[model samples]
Target: MTMTAYLQTMERGDLDSWGTPEDIGSETVEGAPECAGSFDLGSPDDPVFGGLYSVTKGKYRVTYGFHEHATLLDGEVALTNEATGETVVYGPGDSWIIAKGTPVLWDIRSDVARKSYLAVTTDIPA
Candidate 1:
Protein backbone atom coordinates (compact mmCIF):
# COMPACT_ATOMS: atom_id res chain seq x y z
CA MET A 1 0.00 0.00 0.00
CA THR A 2 1.10 3.56 -0.51
CA MET A 3 0.23 6.89 1.07
CA THR A 4 -1.78 9.29 -1.04
CA ALA A 5 -2.38 13.04 -1.44
CA TYR A 6 -4.80 12.81 1.47
CA LEU A 7 -1.90 12.08 3.81
CA GLN A 8 -0.26 14.65 6.03
CA THR A 9 2.82 14.94 8.21
CA MET A 10 2.11 16.74 11.48
CA GLU A 11 4.27 19.07 13.48
CA ARG A 12 3.62 21.79 16.00
CA GLY A 13 2.10 24.65 14.08
CA ASP A 14 1.48 28.28 14.89
CA LEU A 15 -2.01 29.16 16.12
CA ASP A 16 -2.97 29.99 12.55
CA SER A 17 -2.49 26.48 11.16
CA TRP A 18 -5.48 25.03 9.34
CA GLY A 19 -7.57 22.58 11.38
CA THR A 20 -5.43 23.33 14.41
CA PRO A 21 -7.38 23.04 17.66
CA GLU A 22 -7.68 26.79 17.65
CA ASP A 23 -10.13 26.58 14.76
CA ILE A 24 -13.31 26.07 16.72
CA GLY A 25 -16.98 26.89 16.58
CA SER A 26 -19.61 26.53 19.26
CA GLU A 27 -23.10 25.06 19.54
CA THR A 28 -24.78 24.54 22.93
CA VAL A 29 -22.68 21.80 24.72
CA GLU A 30 -21.26 22.48 28.16
CA GLY A 31 -18.01 23.49 29.89
CA ALA A 32 -15.54 25.40 27.78
CA PRO A 33 -12.26 23.56 27.55
CA GLU A 34 -8.76 24.83 27.09
CA CYS A 35 -8.10 23.13 23.79
CA ALA A 36 -5.11 22.62 21.52
CA GLY A 37 -4.36 20.62 18.38
CA SER A 38 -1.66 20.57 15.71
CA PHE A 39 -2.84 19.88 12.19
CA ASP A 40 -1.26 17.00 10.32
CA LEU A 41 -3.35 16.77 7.15
CA GLY A 42 -6.26 18.06 5.14
CA SER A 43 -7.92 21.42 5.38
CA PRO A 44 -11.17 23.27 4.86
CA ASP A 45 -10.22 23.01 1.18
CA ASP A 46 -10.68 19.27 0.83
CA PRO A 47 -13.80 17.18 0.49
CA VAL A 48 -12.23 14.67 2.90
CA PHE A 49 -9.63 15.44 5.53
CA GLY A 50 -8.39 14.77 9.05
CA GLY A 51 -6.04 15.76 11.84
CA LEU A 52 -5.32 15.56 15.56
CA TYR A 53 -7.84 17.12 17.89
CA SER A 54 -8.33 17.25 21.65
CA VAL A 55 -10.48 18.66 24.40
CA THR A 56 -10.17 19.09 28.14
CA LYS A 57 -12.44 17.20 30.52
CA GLY A 58 -15.99 18.50 30.27
CA LYS A 59 -19.50 17.70 29.20
CA TYR A 60 -20.48 18.98 25.80
CA ARG A 61 -22.89 18.58 22.92
CA VAL A 62 -21.70 18.29 19.35
CA THR A 63 -23.55 18.38 16.08
CA TYR A 64 -22.08 16.60 13.10
CA GLY A 65 -22.56 18.20 9.73
CA PHE A 66 -20.15 15.89 7.93
CA HIS A 67 -19.52 12.16 8.10
CA GLU A 68 -16.67 11.36 10.44
CA HIS A 69 -14.89 8.35 11.93
CA ALA A 70 -12.47 8.61 14.82
CA THR A 71 -10.38 6.62 17.23
CA LEU A 72 -10.29 7.53 20.85
CA LEU A 73 -6.57 7.96 21.32
CA ASP A 74 -6.85 8.93 24.97
CA GLY A 75 -9.30 9.50 27.83
CA GLU A 76 -12.76 8.16 28.50
CA VAL A 77 -16.12 9.57 27.50
CA ALA A 78 -19.79 8.89 27.07
CA LEU A 79 -21.68 9.58 23.86
CA THR A 80 -25.43 9.97 23.80
CA ASN A 81 -27.53 10.06 20.69
CA GLU A 82 -29.88 12.98 20.71
CA ALA A 83 -32.74 11.46 18.75
CA THR A 84 -32.86 8.09 20.52
CA GLY A 85 -31.28 8.76 23.89
CA GLU A 86 -28.97 5.82 23.28
CA THR A 87 -25.59 6.22 24.86
CA VAL A 88 -22.23 4.52 24.38
CA VAL A 89 -18.99 4.84 26.27
CA TYR A 90 -15.56 5.08 24.70
CA GLY A 91 -12.06 4.92 26.06
CA PRO A 92 -8.59 4.61 24.69
CA GLY A 93 -8.35 2.28 21.66
CA ASP A 94 -12.01 2.64 20.83
CA SER A 95 -13.18 3.72 17.42
CA TRP A 96 -16.48 5.40 16.62
CA ILE A 97 -18.37 7.11 13.85
CA ILE A 98 -20.73 10.08 13.69
CA ALA A 99 -22.93 10.32 10.66
CA LYS A 100 -23.72 13.55 8.94
CA GLY A 101 -26.45 15.65 10.62
CA THR A 102 -26.43 13.63 13.82
CA PRO A 103 -26.23 15.24 17.22
CA VAL A 104 -24.18 13.82 20.09
CA LEU A 105 -23.29 14.68 23.61
CA TRP A 106 -19.70 14.15 24.69
CA ASP A 107 -19.11 13.64 28.37
CA ILE A 108 -15.37 13.77 28.73
CA ARG A 109 -14.35 11.95 31.90
CA SER A 110 -10.57 12.35 31.89
CA ASP A 111 -8.16 15.17 32.38
CA VAL A 112 -8.02 15.59 28.62
CA ALA A 113 -9.31 13.80 25.56
CA ARG A 114 -7.71 13.21 22.19
CA LYS A 115 -8.68 11.60 18.91
CA SER A 116 -7.45 11.04 15.38
CA TYR A 117 -10.27 11.46 12.93
CA LEU A 118 -11.20 11.60 9.27
CA ALA A 119 -14.15 13.63 8.08
CA VAL A 120 -15.92 13.58 4.74
CA THR A 121 -17.94 16.67 4.10
CA THR A 122 -20.44 17.07 1.31
CA ASP A 123 -20.68 20.73 2.18
CA ILE A 124 -17.42 22.14 3.46
CA PRO A 125 -17.33 24.10 6.68
CA ALA A 126 -16.08 27.62 6.45
Candidate 2:
Protein backbone atom coordinates (compact mmCIF):
# COMPACT_ATOMS: atom_id res chain seq x y z
CA MET A 1 0.00 0.00 0.00
CA THR A 2 1.22 3.50 -0.85
CA MET A 3 1.06 5.74 2.20
CA THR A 4 1.41 9.44 1.56
CA ALA A 5 3.50 11.41 4.00
CA TYR A 6 1.74 14.42 5.47
CA LEU A 7 2.00 17.21 8.00
CA GLN A 8 -0.76 17.94 10.46
CA THR A 9 -1.25 20.92 12.72
CA MET A 10 -2.63 19.80 16.04
CA GLU A 11 -4.75 22.45 17.69
CA ARG A 12 -5.68 22.39 21.34
CA GLY A 13 -9.46 22.37 21.17
CA ASP A 14 -12.49 20.16 21.10
CA LEU A 15 -12.04 16.84 19.30
CA ASP A 16 -14.10 13.76 18.70
CA SER A 17 -14.79 11.95 21.93
CA TRP A 18 -13.28 8.47 22.11
CA GLY A 19 -15.29 7.78 25.24
CA THR A 20 -15.13 8.01 29.00
CA PRO A 21 -11.93 7.44 30.99
CA GLU A 22 -12.55 3.68 31.04
CA ASP A 23 -12.82 3.54 27.27
CA ILE A 24 -9.15 4.37 27.00
CA GLY A 25 -8.04 2.19 29.94
CA SER A 26 -7.87 5.07 32.41
CA GLU A 27 -9.46 5.17 35.83
CA THR A 28 -10.62 8.54 37.11
CA VAL A 29 -9.00 9.13 40.49
CA GLU A 30 -10.56 12.54 41.08
CA GLY A 31 -12.89 15.11 39.50
CA ALA A 32 -14.74 14.22 36.28
CA PRO A 33 -12.62 14.33 33.14
CA GLU A 34 -13.79 14.30 29.56
CA CYS A 35 -11.60 12.56 27.04
CA ALA A 36 -11.39 13.14 23.30
CA GLY A 37 -9.09 12.34 20.41
CA SER A 38 -8.45 12.50 16.72
CA PHE A 39 -6.47 9.67 15.12
CA ASP A 40 -4.93 11.37 12.09
CA LEU A 41 -2.46 8.78 10.91
CA GLY A 42 -2.48 5.01 10.41
CA SER A 43 -5.15 2.46 11.09
CA PRO A 44 -5.71 0.10 13.99
CA ASP A 45 -4.29 -2.63 11.76
CA ASP A 46 -1.10 -0.69 11.30
CA PRO A 47 1.79 -0.83 13.73
CA VAL A 48 2.02 2.94 14.05
CA PHE A 49 -0.64 5.55 14.78
CA GLY A 50 -0.60 9.27 15.41
CA GLY A 51 -3.21 11.53 16.92
CA LEU A 52 -4.24 14.26 19.27
CA TYR A 53 -5.73 13.57 22.69
CA SER A 54 -7.22 15.86 25.29
CA VAL A 55 -8.69 15.57 28.75
CA THR A 56 -10.33 17.97 31.13
CA LYS A 57 -9.09 18.85 34.61
CA GLY A 58 -8.84 15.79 36.87
CA LYS A 59 -6.57 13.05 38.05
CA TYR A 60 -6.41 9.65 36.43
CA ARG A 61 -4.38 6.47 36.24
CA VAL A 62 -3.58 4.61 33.07
CA THR A 63 -1.17 1.97 31.85
CA TYR A 64 0.37 2.21 28.43
CA GLY A 65 -0.31 -0.79 26.25
CA PHE A 66 1.82 0.54 23.38
CA HIS A 67 4.97 2.60 23.03
CA GLU A 68 4.27 6.31 22.55
CA HIS A 69 5.97 9.65 22.10
CA ALA A 70 3.88 12.72 22.90
CA THR A 71 4.09 16.49 22.99
CA LEU A 72 1.93 18.74 25.03
CA LEU A 73 0.12 21.31 22.91
CA ASP A 74 -1.58 23.29 25.67
CA GLY A 75 -2.36 23.35 29.39
CA GLU A 76 -0.32 21.97 32.27
CA VAL A 77 -0.02 18.52 33.79
CA ALA A 78 2.03 16.57 36.28
CA LEU A 79 2.70 13.02 35.17
CA THR A 80 3.92 10.48 37.68
CA ASN A 81 5.47 7.27 36.49
CA GLU A 82 3.99 4.84 38.97
CA ALA A 83 6.67 2.18 38.57
CA THR A 84 9.50 4.66 39.11
CA GLY A 85 7.63 7.00 41.45
CA GLU A 86 9.12 9.88 39.51
CA THR A 87 7.05 12.86 38.49
CA VAL A 88 7.44 15.49 35.81
CA VAL A 89 5.49 18.65 35.23
CA TYR A 90 4.69 19.44 31.62
CA GLY A 91 3.14 22.42 29.92
CA PRO A 92 2.73 23.62 26.38
CA GLY A 93 5.55 22.42 24.11
CA ASP A 94 6.79 19.75 26.51
CA SER A 95 7.43 16.26 25.17
CA TRP A 96 8.10 12.76 26.47
CA ILE A 97 8.07 9.10 25.60
CA ILE A 98 6.37 6.28 27.38
CA ALA A 99 7.13 2.58 26.95
CA LYS A 100 4.57 -0.13 26.83
CA GLY A 101 3.28 -1.38 30.21
CA THR A 102 4.35 1.81 31.98
CA PRO A 103 1.76 2.88 34.46
CA VAL A 104 1.12 6.62 34.76
CA LEU A 105 -0.75 8.87 37.13
CA TRP A 106 -1.97 11.99 35.35
CA ASP A 107 -2.70 15.12 37.33
CA ILE A 108 -4.30 17.69 35.07
CA ARG A 109 -3.30 21.00 36.59
CA SER A 110 -4.95 23.28 34.07
CA ASP A 111 -8.50 23.63 32.86
CA VAL A 112 -7.59 21.09 30.19
CA ALA A 113 -4.58 19.36 28.76
CA ARG A 114 -3.98 18.44 25.14
CA LYS A 115 -1.23 16.50 23.43
CA SER A 116 -0.25 15.07 20.10
CA TYR A 117 1.11 11.53 20.07
CA LEU A 118 2.57 8.84 17.91
CA ALA A 119 2.23 5.28 19.11
CA VAL A 120 3.56 1.90 18.04
CA THR A 121 2.14 -1.50 18.79
CA THR A 122 3.17 -5.01 17.82
CA ASP A 123 -0.30 -6.47 18.01
CA ILE A 124 -2.96 -5.47 15.50
CA PRO A 125 -6.55 -6.53 15.82
CA ALA A 126 -7.78 -8.83 13.11
Candidate 3:
Protein backbone atom coordinates (compact mmCIF):
# COMPACT_ATOMS: atom_id res chain seq x y z
CA MET A 1 0.00 0.00 0.00
CA THR A 2 1.02 3.59 -0.60
CA MET A 3 1.94 5.96 2.24
CA THR A 4 -1.43 7.63 2.02
CA ALA A 5 -3.18 4.30 2.44
CA TYR A 6 -1.08 3.51 5.49
CA LEU A 7 -1.93 6.87 7.01
CA GLN A 8 -5.61 6.29 6.44
CA THR A 9 -5.44 2.98 8.23
CA MET A 10 -3.60 4.58 11.14
CA GLU A 11 -6.28 7.21 11.51
CA ARG A 12 -8.89 4.50 11.85
CA GLY A 13 -7.02 2.60 14.56
CA ASP A 14 -6.74 3.70 18.20
CA LEU A 15 -3.18 4.46 19.15
CA ASP A 16 -2.01 4.12 22.75
CA SER A 17 -2.51 7.22 24.86
CA TRP A 18 0.61 9.25 25.49
CA GLY A 19 -0.41 11.82 28.11
CA THR A 20 -2.77 14.69 29.01
CA PRO A 21 -4.16 17.94 27.53
CA GLU A 22 -4.90 16.24 24.25
CA ASP A 23 -5.10 18.59 21.30
CA ILE A 24 -5.17 17.63 17.62
CA GLY A 25 -4.67 19.52 14.40
CA SER A 26 -3.41 19.21 10.84
CA GLU A 27 -1.50 21.55 8.59
CA THR A 28 -0.62 21.74 4.91
CA VAL A 29 2.23 24.04 4.10
CA GLU A 30 2.26 26.06 0.93
CA GLY A 31 4.64 24.67 -1.72
CA ALA A 32 5.23 21.71 0.57
CA PRO A 33 5.26 18.12 -0.65
CA GLU A 34 2.65 16.72 1.77
CA CYS A 35 0.12 17.40 4.53
CA ALA A 36 0.55 16.70 8.26
CA GLY A 37 -1.64 15.83 11.21
CA SER A 38 -0.45 16.28 14.81
CA PHE A 39 -1.52 15.60 18.36
CA ASP A 40 0.08 18.11 20.68
CA LEU A 41 1.02 17.99 24.35
CA GLY A 42 -0.50 20.87 26.29
CA SER A 43 2.70 22.26 27.78
CA PRO A 44 3.47 25.83 26.78
CA ASP A 45 7.20 25.61 27.35
CA ASP A 46 9.65 23.54 25.33
CA PRO A 47 9.09 20.69 22.86
CA VAL A 48 7.57 17.31 23.73
CA PHE A 49 6.19 18.56 27.03
CA GLY A 50 3.96 15.79 28.33
CA GLY A 51 2.54 14.66 25.02
CA LEU A 52 2.61 12.02 22.31
CA TYR A 53 2.72 12.51 18.54
CA SER A 54 2.40 10.44 15.39
CA VAL A 55 3.37 11.50 11.92
CA THR A 56 0.48 10.64 9.64
CA LYS A 57 1.96 11.91 6.39
CA GLY A 58 5.53 13.14 5.85
CA LYS A 59 8.91 13.36 7.56
CA TYR A 60 9.62 15.88 10.31
CA ARG A 61 12.24 16.92 12.81
CA VAL A 62 12.65 19.02 15.96
CA THR A 63 14.98 22.02 15.91
CA TYR A 64 15.16 23.29 19.46
CA GLY A 65 14.26 22.40 23.02
CA PHE A 66 14.62 24.71 25.95
CA HIS A 67 14.01 21.70 28.18
CA GLU A 68 13.98 17.90 27.93
CA HIS A 69 11.39 15.18 28.52
CA ALA A 70 11.75 11.48 29.27
CA THR A 71 10.53 8.88 26.79
CA LEU A 72 8.24 6.08 27.82
CA LEU A 73 8.52 4.10 24.58
CA ASP A 74 10.28 3.90 21.26
CA GLY A 75 10.03 6.90 18.95
CA GLU A 76 11.80 8.67 16.09
CA VAL A 77 13.64 12.01 16.30
CA ALA A 78 15.99 13.78 13.89
CA LEU A 79 18.56 15.92 15.63
CA THR A 80 21.66 17.96 14.79
CA ASN A 81 24.26 18.24 17.51
CA GLU A 82 25.23 21.77 18.42
CA ALA A 83 28.66 20.75 19.75
CA THR A 84 29.66 18.55 16.80
CA GLY A 85 27.39 20.18 14.26
CA GLU A 86 26.45 16.70 13.08
CA THR A 87 23.04 15.34 12.12
CA VAL A 88 21.69 12.00 13.27
CA VAL A 89 18.51 10.11 12.52
CA TYR A 90 16.71 7.80 14.96
CA GLY A 91 14.53 4.95 13.81
CA PRO A 92 11.19 3.78 15.12
CA GLY A 93 11.15 2.20 18.65
CA ASP A 94 14.06 4.33 19.79
CA SER A 95 13.54 6.04 23.15
CA TRP A 96 14.83 9.19 24.92
CA ILE A 97 17.13 10.37 22.17
CA ILE A 98 16.90 13.95 23.36
CA ALA A 99 17.72 14.99 26.89
CA LYS A 100 18.98 18.04 28.77
CA GLY A 101 21.95 20.15 27.55
CA THR A 102 21.32 19.16 23.94
CA PRO A 103 20.94 21.66 21.12
CA VAL A 104 19.92 20.46 17.67
CA LEU A 105 18.17 21.14 14.38
CA TRP A 106 15.29 19.13 12.93
CA ASP A 107 14.74 18.34 9.29
CA ILE A 108 11.48 16.75 8.26
CA ARG A 109 11.57 15.02 4.88
CA SER A 110 7.80 14.56 5.00
CA ASP A 111 4.92 15.77 7.09
CA VAL A 112 5.21 13.79 10.32
CA ALA A 113 3.61 13.86 13.76
CA ARG A 114 5.16 11.93 16.65
CA LYS A 115 3.65 10.63 19.84
CA SER A 116 5.89 12.08 22.55
CA TYR A 117 6.42 11.79 26.33
CA LEU A 118 7.73 15.06 27.67
CA ALA A 119 8.59 16.43 31.13
CA VAL A 120 9.68 19.98 31.76
CA THR A 121 13.18 20.61 33.06
CA THR A 122 11.94 22.12 36.27
CA ASP A 123 9.97 19.01 37.06
CA ILE A 124 13.05 16.83 36.64
CA PRO A 125 15.39 16.86 39.63
CA ALA A 126 19.00 17.85 39.05
**Ten consecutive residues with minimal summed lDDT in candidate 1?**
13-22
| lDDT top scorer | 2
For model 1, what is the alpha-carbon lDDT of residue 30? Answer: 64
Model 1: per-residue Cα lDDT over 6-122, one tens digit each: 222433233322232224553435665556654456774678887766777777666786788888777788889887899999987888988887878878889877777888888
If candidate 3 were superposed on the true structure by all CA atoms, what would the RMSD be?
A: 9.7
lDDT of 1: 0.69
Given candidate 2, what's the lDDT at residue 54? 91
Instruction: Flag regions of model 1 displaced more than 4 Å.
Output: 1-23, 123-126
Summarize candidate 2's per-residue lDDT along 1-126 as a digit string, tens digits: 544232235434568987768888889999998899888888555789888889999999999888889988888999999999999999888899988888999999999888888898874443
Q: What lDDT does the true structure give each of the candidates?
A: 0.69, 0.84, 0.42
Ranking by TM-score: 2, 1, 3
The local distance difference test score of model 2 is 0.84
TM-score of each: 0.74, 0.85, 0.43
Which scores greater on TM-score, model 1 or model 3? Answer: 1
